[model samples]
Target: MAPTKPLLLDGSTGEGGGQLVRLAVALSAVTGQPIRIVNIRANRTRSRPVGKRGSVHVTGGGLKNQHVAAIKCLADATRAETTGLSAGSATLTFTPTLPPSRLPRRPLKIVPESDASSAMLIFQAVLPFLLFADVEEGQGVEVEIHGGTNTSWSLNYEYMDLVLLPTLEARFGVRVERELRRRGWSQGPAASGCVWVKVYPVRKGESITPLQLPIPLGKERDTRGPRDHFEVESVDVALVVPLRLLEPLQTALARDIAGVFPSAPEIDFRVVEDSGHQARIYVLLVAKSPTGLRWGRDVLHSPPKGSSANPTSMADALSRLAVKQLVEEVDSRGAVDVYLQDQLVCFQALAAGRSSFARHGDGRGGGVDVDGVAGAPGPTPDIEGDGLRREKTHEPFGHGSMHTKTARWVAAQLLPGVQFFNKGDVVEGAGIRFA
Candidate 1:
């Protein structure tokens, strides 16, 4: 049974960004719970000089355009009621109708008030609700998000299309088909674009499959010493830049990939699209494991305004940086990128059973078992009894990025039944069923 009083959350805690609000609302809708969040996006308030000569600094905070758009879209889909659904409201109360109503058959559309708002951020906010929505069999929910597709400090469209969507489908059985109508940019000149996504919700009476990311050298037969590293089987490079810089970008990318993974087979490099503006240049490099896991890194390079920099030099620099970051990621041997690790916390908490993955991509396979409670440590899986009881002294869940910790904290607040262990490498889920 649903609780009578609304759950209260402090928006200033943890990551203290718009994502906290997004996850809170989506979980509230899915679980048919009411929530009240105070001090929303409190830490996100920023002051920057905007006027001529950078003389005056204007400060802005609270819900942004994309945040409101996501909230409204989820509210409409779930027939949920909201209080303080405005541009800069500090508090929000969201109450979803109990026993979730059936979502409409037609597609839903969302347009942010600002062209610079990230469409992917909006998509992330509503994905959980849509994945568990009450939809008919052989049917999918369509969402058309019109805003900045490649905005700064957010996941871009190509990353979603190439990395996130595929990983979700393969690991969790959640499928989403994407269609990009046009490119949007926040760099150089700001322009709005559209991305249509058709999400295939989990079937009635079924729950999302628990994610089980493979450990690098846990195999019994391949005991080739203890130093086992993550293997990169293939590479996919996607570029979007001006027509003139395409050749140099390609050349630089190829050289970097060769230097990084010369032994790896199957490298596919291509220009997915051409950015019309000289200021807009983006590169994404994804490394795939034989087990189908992917780790990706990207950079949306925006040269200094009015700087007379060489375009070819700029392209080469961007390629080198992007590839260098990717090499670091691969070297880390993480099951997913740093960003994706945190993003999966919500799913792990809501899924049907235990979901376990690697804690660190350090290539050395080991995990420190964690207690269900936060900040407390538990026993090591290999150790025994009272001797190992003292092992729980350290902060067991302190491995992931702040974003990861924030997402994990949000999941814990919304779904109390879920338990985290192994520094968030293992999740005992709520087993939430859509039907």
Candidate 2:
């Protein structure tokens, strides 16, 4: 039975970003609970001019174009009623009309209001409901999303297709087939694109198998130390840049990979498409363990603002930056990178039994640092203009990123039976089933 009173969530909690809204609404739809979020995106504050004398004043909060789209799309999928459904709203309520078991397994489509809105973010927001939806044997749901595939602050389409989906299937028995119909880029003039996702949802009576920690075998290389590092047997690189820079990027990538990994794992150029504009340059490197564990690190290059900027130098720098970040991830000896570390939390809460992953290094709190930035892989939301700036927390607890910590917090709030221990290294799932 649905709760008579809506579960209240403070938007300023934890990471206090779009993720809270995404996870809350998805959980509400799947668990048949109603949620009311106040102070939405409160920590995300924007600065504007107070007068004409160049003095700036801070104004904060509210949903972006992509966030509002995610809530509405998920509501449509589950027949949920919503309040404050417009963009820039600071408070919202979501109440599903139908229970999880009654959600029909049918094709759904999502089109974001702006070309710059991330399709992958929309995918993350609605995926849980689809996964827990009612469906017959041999039945699946198809979701088509339209928006930017490579956005500034969100996960790109290539990462989801090559890394995220595969790891989910390999580790937790959740299968989602992703196909890219067209390429989208937010850097160069905000291009629109499309993606088709077919989900093999967990049926009414069946539940997702619990996640088990990966056993640490000996390292793939001849390292004279502990026998705890999981072997990275191969690496796949996806590079999207101008056609003129292809050979240079490939050369730099090979040199960097050899210098860092030293294990001589098989390197495959999975994607080598031309991004059509120099500003749209992006690269993703995914390391695969023989145990089916995958970790990914990527960057969408934002070239210096100058007509005199050299394309060759920028491309080389982009390659070097991506390589350096990915090497950091591989050296940490964690099962997943900082981003995926948190992304998996929701699934852990939804599954039955216990789920855990090997903590990175001594399991102390740490995060990925690209160039000199602390928290995010891309441009940390611009706080000066209409953008918001947030800080990263490194308090000692399982070494998970702020996003990871926030995700675990949200799951625990929505699913009472789910409990997290050792920071977020271990979790007891809610064992959610449609039937």
Q: Please list the C-alpha lDDT of all candidates, in the order they appear.
A: 0.74, 0.74
Task: Report the poorest 10 consecutive residues by lDDT, candidate 1.
Answer: 387-396
Kindly list the per-residue Cα lDDT of model 1 for residues 294-346, writing each as its tens digit: 78898888777786867678777888899888888877655577777777877
> What clash pairs does model 1 have?
332-361, 333-361, 334-361, 377-392
Q: Against the true structure, what is each candidate's TM-score? A: 0.86, 0.85
Candidate 2 lDDT, 1-435, residue by residue in tens: 555579899888878888888998888888878899988888787555666767564544588888888888877766787898888788999988786666655688888788888989999988887887667766778999998899878989989988888778866888898899987888877689899998888867777765443434653463764332345678899988877778888888887787777667789999998888867788999987655566799988767556565656666687789988887777776667778877887888888865655344553322322211111122223232122222222221344677777787788778887755544565667888866
Q: For candidate 2, what is the lDDT?
A: 0.74
For candidate 1, the per-residue lDDT at 186 reads: 90
- The TM-score of predicted model 2 comes to 0.85
